[model samples]
Target: MALGSKKLRVYVWFTLPALLLYIGFFFYPALMGLNYSLTNWDGMARTYRYIGLSNYAAIFKDERFLHALGFTFKYTLIVVVAKLAIALGLALLLTSRMRFRSFFRSIYFFPAVLSLITIGLIFNEIFFTILPVIGEALGIEPLSRNILGNKDTALYGILIANIWHGVAVPMVIFMAGLSSVPKDLHEAATIDGAGKRQRFFSITLPFLIPMLNVNLVLLIKGGLTVFDSIVAMTDGGPGTSTESIGFLIYRHGMLENKFGYATAESIFVFAMIAIISYVQMKWLNKQEVGQQ
Candidate 1:
């Protein structure tokens, strides 16, 4: 009992600092934000009054906020689907017997090392300058203009930049998942006259589910909280068509100084992410269990 109690004390000593830091930095601020959300403070005001959910009610009625919420959901859906599909595909290709596999993997993963802002700026230039020249040369009407200039196609242009920057980690993750799949199972499946597709569906995919869940949550969060890429590329423009919830929060909170309202929106987003992620995890857990 003495030895075990000493070990527990040592563990607590090691963990206490990090736990306190987390509470100070994250938990405390979150509580403050929640408090602020119930108020009418503009952040610089010397005197502010608690409005008690007025901000939340106003946000629901605000058209721009509604539009941003819708836009973020759409972006999240497209991003999650595209990233998962492409990353899984790339992971499979690289894990297979192919020449210069390491070289291709490195090349594909290189973009992930770059900052989203840098990637956005580079793609911004490509859309603004290089693509137009190529488009004109090819006599393509759509390409002849700046892709980011049109609200209709701006989302896709932003998506192109995001996907390029985002897919690498998921690819690496899926590769790790693929590697853990037992080779002996594949050998057995092959002897049973199972083809590649059958084996993948029956065996490989089951193992990839947990990894898929992880990647899904990650992509969802990234999509929902996307900011820098949009700022660098669009700055919530082509007339607010590409504006996301994160950008809207920044615009209101930092730029417009509507701090209280933005905090309310932030809390709403927090709830949304929590609820969606929880539901997804639950559903995926069922899938995992079913596979077993």
Candidate 2:
């Protein structure tokens, strides 16, 4: 008992600092934001009144907010689906018996190491300049124009940039998962006359379920909270068509000084993310169990 107590004391001493920092930085700020969401503070006034739910109520009536919310969901879905598909494809290709596999894996993963803001800026120039010139040369009218300026095509342009930057991490994840798939299983399946597709679906895919869940959850979160890429590329334009909830919060709370209202919107986004994550995790867990 004495030795266990001594070990516990040592562990507490090591953990306490990080635990306190987490509470101070993350937990405390979240609680404070929740409280501020109930008030009418403009972020500058010394005196503020508690407006209790008024800001929350006003969010549903705000057309721009609603538009932003809808656009965010749409953007999230596009990015998540595209990212996963391309990542899985690349992962499968890289894991195959090919020369310079390591080199190609590194090349594919290199973009993930670059800052999203940097990737966004690089792609911004390409979209606005290089692509336009190519489009004109090719006699493609739509490509010749500013894609980021066209409301109909702006989100799709952002989606393209996001997928380019985002696919690397998930590809690396899928590669790791694929590495664990037993060669013996593949050999046995081949001896049994099972084709590649049949073997992949029956054997390799079952082993990749855990990694799939991880990648899905991560991509979903990244899709929903995407702000830096959009900001760097289009700055929520042309005319707020690409504004996500994160950008909305920054615009309202930081730029417009509507701290309370923005906080309410942020809380709404948090709830949305939480609910979606929970549902996805539950569903994915079921799939994992079924595969097992």
Candidate 3:
């Protein structure tokens, strides 16, 4: 009993600083935001009055807010699917016997190290300058104009940049999962004349479920909270066509000075991320269990 108590004390002593930091940085701000969200603060007013969910009420009725929410969902869906598929494919290819496999893995992972804002800036120039030239040379009508200038195609341009930048980490994750898969099962399956696809489906994919769950949660969170890429690439333009929830919050709070309203929007985003992530994780956990 004494030893267990001593161990607990040591653990608590080590953990206390991190716990305090989390509460100070995250929990405290969240509580304050929730408090201010019920008022009409406007960020600079000396005095404010409690409005009691008026900001939230107005949020649902605001067309711009609604559009931002919808666009965020759409972006998240496309990014999650594309990233997962591309990353998994890359992982499979790299795991196979190939020339300079380690070099290829390093090359593929290089993008994950670059800042999203930097990537967005680079791609912004690509879309604005290079692609238009190529499009004109090739007589391709869509590429002739700047992709970021068209509301209809702006989202796709963002997706292209996002996929290129985001795919590396998930590929590394999938590679880690693939590495853990037992080779004996593949050898045994081959001895029984099982083909590559059959072995992959029966043996390999099951081992990948946990990694899949991890990647899904990561992709979902990233999609929902995306801000830097939009800011750097289009600044939520082609006239608000690619406005995301994160960008909307920043615009309202920092640009428009609607602090209370922006706080309300941020709280909504928090709730949204939590709910969606919970549902997704639950579903994926069931899949993990079923695979077992």
Candidate 4:
């Protein structure tokens, strides 16, 4: 027992370096962000005036900030829903014993491996060109008036590209979840005369709930952080109609030199994410309990 305890102590000592590195890098920076948000600080200023809650107050009063917040939440919600529904359907389809299934899965997952900037550039042409090369050869127009160039349609166009790009993540996760489900359960359901839809709802979907919960949270977080695609595609353009809170905060810190204000905005984004994640986790847990 004495030798075992000594080895355990040595193992704990070995893990300290990793823990210290994580605390120094990630958590320390995050705490500093919270601290800076309470001060009125420019980037290289000699003094940062402590402003208490003024920075937070300004966020509520700024019309542009409010608009950006609203738009960001709306964009996040829309893309998340679209991705979940589409990815779930694709997961179900591809998991079936269908033809050339590996090829189909690769095609679905391919976009996920592409860089965000590359995907944005490729889709930029798709949404802007009156006719793609193949479309022109087939005498079919691919699109009209650059979708990303218009104030009215620019935001919606971004959402479309995001959903298209994000589906593979959930699909892969769901495919894994589906595979882990017991085959005997599905076989028994079929033997008991459960139809396809019934079997899916009763057995498959119930078991998939945990993975769905995880992927849903990831999709929402990814949608909130969307920037590269929006920047490359619309440049927040036509009139800031597609401007997101992430970009708004970015411009504040880098362009306007309002570090404190940007920090406040970032804090707000973090809170929104935390609250949304908490609510979703609670709901998912409830659903899991009810299913069991």
Model 3: lowest-lDDT 10 consecutive positions:
283-292
Candidates, ranked, TM-score = 1, 2, 3, 4
lDDT of 3: 0.94
lDDT of 2 by residue, 1-26 (tens): 99999999999999999999999999
TM-score of 2: 0.96
- Model 4 residue 191 distance off true place after TM-score fit, in angstroms: 2.9
TM-score of each: 0.97, 0.96, 0.95, 0.92
- Summarize candidate 4's per-residue lDDT along 60-137 as a digit string, tens digits: 999998888788889988988889899999998998989999999999999899877888888888876733455666
Best of the two (2, 3) by TM-score: 2
The local distance difference test score of each candidate is 0.95, 0.90, 0.94, 0.86
lDDT of 3 by residue, 184-279 (tens): 989999999999899988889888988998999899999999999999999999899999999999999989989999999999988988898899
Off by over 4 Å in 2: 289-292
C-alpha lDDT (0 to 100) for residue 185 of candidate 1: 93
Runs of candidate 1 with Cα error greater than 4 angstroms are 289-292
Best by lDDT: 1
Ranking by lDDT: 1, 3, 2, 4
